[model samples]
Each structure stands twice: as structure tokens, then as C-alpha cells.
Target: AVAFCESVQPLEAVVSLMAQRLALAEDVARYKWNQKVEIEDSAREQMIITKLKAQAVAEGLPEAWSETFFKAQIAASKATQKQLFAEWQQHHAAAFEGVPDLNSQTRPKLYALMSELITALHQAWQPLQQPECQPVVDKLVREKLAKPGYKVAGEPLFAVH
Candidate 1:
């Protein structure tokens, strides 16, 4: 009987016990109480947590730094990716609409824009693909490089030669 009851009991029932003491109705109160508990715990630990965070940075801890750097890079990459994709979309749309090719006089400007975009793609994708970030960045690069007209080589992504 005990085993049967324990097996059938929802986890929430156990969690809801303390909340019932606070004059809150069971279901709604449980959620509100849990949120308050979480907020209170976070608030109480804020100072210690902040100190630990600072220590992590001051220590130059590789794993922590890698995690934080990856997060920042992810944000930057997303922004850059959006901009690059937008430009690609714009150029593609224009081409589809029969935009005229640049005259010889304007060819340099078109080439410059194209070069800048390629450089942007490299900058955004390369860092993310470094050994530290390989798992995530490699996937993105693979996906992007799969598109027609995109070229990828097995050599180093950057210049050391």
C-alpha cells in the first residue's frame, strides 16, 4: 500500500506541502510560493554569487572564460549573421528583379561591398569555429558552406603562412 501510494503520488504533491501552510490555495499558491522562494534565494545569494563571478574573471579561468566568451560571441554572431543575411537577401532580391550590373566606373564600389561581406562572414564564422568553440561554430560553418557558391577549403581558416 505504501509503495503503491508513493508510486502514484505526483512530485508536485510533495512540493506543495509547505505552501499549504502559508494560507495560499494549493495549486496557485504553490507556483507563487515557488517563484518567491526562488527570487528570495537569488537575492540572498547575490553578493556571494557576484563575488564568485568576479573571482572567475580575475582568475582567467579557461572554462568559465570560454563559456562567457562563447555567449558573447554567440550574441555578436547572431547580429552579424542577421546583417550579412539581410545584405545577401537584398542583393539576391535585386538580382532577381533584374537590377543592372554596375558600369566600369561603379565596379570598384560593388567589388568593395562584396569583399567586405565576405570578410564579415569569415570574421563571424572563424572565431566560432576555433577549437574552443568548435562544436557550435563548426556546425554553423558547415550549414553556411553547404549553400551553392560558398567555397570552403581544408587549410587553416586564418593566415599563419
Candidate 2:
């Protein structure tokens, strides 16, 4: 959905996808919690980042830059999940109802969105490297990923070298 969404700028589309990905953390956390799964999955995270870095190379984008951006998204997602877990714990909440399976459903969706995000980011790569893009990217990030735990490092993420 994020990938096909019409936008004036590819960079804006990037932010939208990032926001969409972050938003999915809720369902992910719920499913994980309901299934008694751990919040941190370092192995899977590394695998994903590594895979994306390789893809970034193929796309003519800087690997570290791409990793940084995705890492920020992961961090924000984890933060939101952790916060949700804490709240659920304090409230002694029951398992979430109607959450999608992480493997069969959620992950496939996330991968699709990630693919689109990569394409959008590649399209916006040149402009994103400009110094002037920092403020604009930061502003968009703030507006799109506005939730408290969803906030990322903002302007600092645009420096791709």
C-alpha cells in the first residue's frame, strides 16, 4: 500500500513507508506477546539488515546509509513494542484478539513494504544526499512518525555518505 500510494516526492513516499512500517509494530507486538515470543530478535534483525545492505549495493546506494535508515525504523518499532508490552504487563492484559500471524501474514506484508521502500529510497537517493534535504526529511519524519516511541533520529539520518 505504501509503495503504490501517490506522492509528490519520492522522499515523502519513503517517509510514508517508514511510518507504515513503524505502525505495523502494534500488530507485531500483539502477535508476539500473544504467542509468548520475545521482543528482541537480534539474529533476524541482523539477517534482514545484511540482506538489505546487499540489495542496497545492487541499487547503487551506500550500504551503511541504508542500514542506518532501516535500523532507525527497527529501533522505533522495538521501542513502541516494548512500551506496549510494558503497558500490557502493568494492566495485566489478555492476549490480543484477531492479530495476524507474524510469519505467514505480517512478515510477508512487511517484506513487500520494505521492497517498495527500497525502490523509493533508491529513486530519491541523489536528492537525499544534499545538505538541504536534512531539514525537509527531518520535518517529514516528525510529522509522519509522530507517535512518541516512533520518533527516530530525524535530520541526522539524511547524511548518506
Candidate 3:
């Protein structure tokens, strides 16, 4: 099981990055709200997906599977943003002051995280298919994953099933 755990380490890192990105979404949502911008930017999302697909191919991971995993990350981030926005609105929260520029401050950080995630995915791809991977991932997620002020719902992005 040591090898199994080692193999899934990269996958765990990817998930940890996802969690970090979700935490960043709170800042993103606040920035968007302050700027009067919509949270769902299809064009930007498509661009990211396209870029990730190409990167995945270059890194020896299947493009389709990589895209699916990336879509999950995008979906999770958006869900977190939506939930945060709703809560803020419900509370009649005051507008956030001096929000950082999304393009310069936020997107750059997210982009860096994406790069790390892609690298991790490439490292984990084959080992992720091992029979022991699922249970080990479950254990690690339960024991080691940080709670980043949001729930991680939906399917495990890299799990076999």
C-alpha cells in the first residue's frame, strides 16, 4: 500500500490545488461583484479548457480525460462562487472595498494553480487506474485534505468510476 499511496500523491496534490482554487473563488466573487461582472464567463472557460487539453496531450495524458477533469474543477469553482454570491446577497453584505483586479491578481494565481494541477495529473494518470487507487484516495482525502470553506461535492474527478 506504500507504493499505492505514493502513486496517488500527485492526485492528492491536484485535489489540494482545487481546494485552494475554490478558496480563491471567494476573492474572485467579491471582485466580480464589485466590478459588476458576471461569474460565468463561457468564453474564458472555453479558452482554459482548450489550453488544458493541449497541455494534457503534450504531457502524455489523454486529452478527453484531462478535459473532463478540468471541467469538474471549473464546475466546482463556479459552484463555490455562486454559493458565496448568494450568501453575500442574502446577508445584504456591503460592497467589498478595494477589491484586487481579477485579471492581474486573481487570474494569475489561478493560472499558476492550473499549471500545477496539470503537472500533477500527468504524474498521476497511469497510477490512478490501479485498483488500490480509489481506496487510497478516499483515505487521503478524508485524512489529509483541507476544508477550504466550501464543500467538495460531485464525483471524484480522477477516480476510476
Q: Which candidate's lDDT is highest?
A: 2
Estimate every model's Cα lDDT from 0 to 1.
0.30, 0.78, 0.73
TM-score of each: 0.24, 0.87, 0.83
TM-score: which candidate is best?
2
In model 2, which regions exceed 4 Å deviation? Answer: 1-8, 153-156
Instruction: Provide the lDDT at 26 for model 1.
Output: 23
Candidate RMSDs in Å, in order, are 25.1, 5.6, 3.1
Task: Please provide, for model 1 over 96-131, each residue's C-alpha lDDT reduced to its tens digit, 9 standing for 90 to 100.
Answer: 232233233323442343233233332344343344
Compared with the true structure, model 1 gives a TM-score of 0.24
lDDT of 1 at 155: 17
Badly placed stretches (over 4 Å) of model 3 are 1-8, 141-161
Q: Report the C-alpha lDDT of model 3 over 30-146, residue by residue, as the tens digit.
A: 998887789999999999999878987888877777777777677777887888788888998888987878999999998888888878866776666776676766665555443
On the 0 to 100 scale, the lDDT of residue 68 in model 2 is 86
Residue 66 lDDT, candidate 1, scale 0-100: 28
